[model samples]
Target: MHLNNDHLISLAETFKLLGDPTRLAILVACLEQEKTVGQIVSDTGASQSLVSHHLRLLRGARLIQPRRDGRHIYYHAHDQHIRCTLQDMIEHIQEEER
Candidate 1:
């Protein structure tokens, strides 16, 4: 499919979202289990505020979704598309390195 400039820019932002190691790690962590902000902090060893910041960026890019449970917000991949895209990207990168 052909993407217009705007769509291409959006796609770039999505890939840029994954460009950060912290965000990538967060995505990987969520792949195993849906997690609350606190859980993400504990698992990633990042400060809660820093994790929240990355979460906001991921949510803005539509890579992840947050569900509210009372006062807590649980974040998870919105769909498998992001996961599949990431897997494919990784395989491509590995192939290039070889």
Candidate 2:
């Protein structure tokens, strides 16, 4: 896929968002199950406000999506693409460790 300047810039932005450890933890926490802000905080050991902030940024990037139920919002990866991409990247790193 040929990425133009605009596309490259957007891709860079997405990587920047994913570069933060806290944000990565938040995403990993919600990978297998949709999690509320409280659950994310517990899983990531980040403050609730911090988790919310990262959640907003991730939602904006479309890397994570939200579903509302009553007064609670559940966050999770929108589809298999992110999961598969992460799994592939993990394997790549593991192979490098050999």
Candidate 3:
């Protein structure tokens, strides 16, 4: 596909975001289901403070999205594009191992 300069820049920024292990873990935790901050912490063993911080960056990057149910907020993989991209990348690596 043809990507303009802005598109390329944004793509690079997205890669930079995914380069973080913590943030990547958080995203993996939300891949299949929506999770609250506490659930994410439980899944990844990251502190609430740390999870919250990463969530902000992930949200800003549009890699994940937040939903509110009353006082609690749930986060999930942003959309099919992100979800599929992540899943596909994982598969790519797994394929190499085989």
Candidate 4:
């Protein structure tokens, strides 16, 4: 498939967003289930503010989806595409560790 300039730019931006460890951790935290910001903070051992900041960026990138239930917001991977991509990456890292 031929990627035009716009497609290349969009892909680059998405990679840039994913390049952040905090953001990647946030996404990984939601791989199996949706999580609140506090849950992500606990899982990632990151500050609430930092997780929230990355959440906003991930949401903007459409890598995650957020739903509001009362005062709490739950976030999860936006689609199977993200889940599969993350899964593949995890496997790659595990392979490297061997």
* Per-candidate local distance difference test: 0.85, 0.90, 0.97, 0.95
In terms of lDDT, the poorest run of 10 residues in model 3 is: 88-97
Which consecutive 10 residues in model 4 have the weakest lDDT in total? 50-59
Rank ordering of all candidates by lDDT, starting from the highest: 3, 4, 2, 1
Q: Which of the numbered candidates is closest to the native, going by highest lDDT? A: 3
Report residue 27 deviation for candidate 4 (angstroms). Answer: 0.6
* lDDT (Cα, tens digit) per residue for candidate 2, span 45-73: 99989999999999999889899999999
lDDT score, residue 77, model 4? 99
As for candidate 2, its clashing pairs are: none
Q: Cα RMSDs of all predictions? A: 2.4, 1.4, 0.9, 0.9
Error of 1 at 65 (Å): 0.4
Off by over 4 Å in 1: 90-98
Show pairs that collide, candidate 4.
none
List runs of model 3 lying over 4 Å from the truth.
none
Clashes of each: 0, 0, 0, 0
Worst 10 residues of 1 by lDDT: 25-34
Task: Give model 3's TM-score versus the native structure.
Answer: 0.95
Report the lDDT tens digits of candidate 3 across residue range 1-98: 89999999999999999999999999999999999999999999999999999999999999999999999999999999999999999999899889
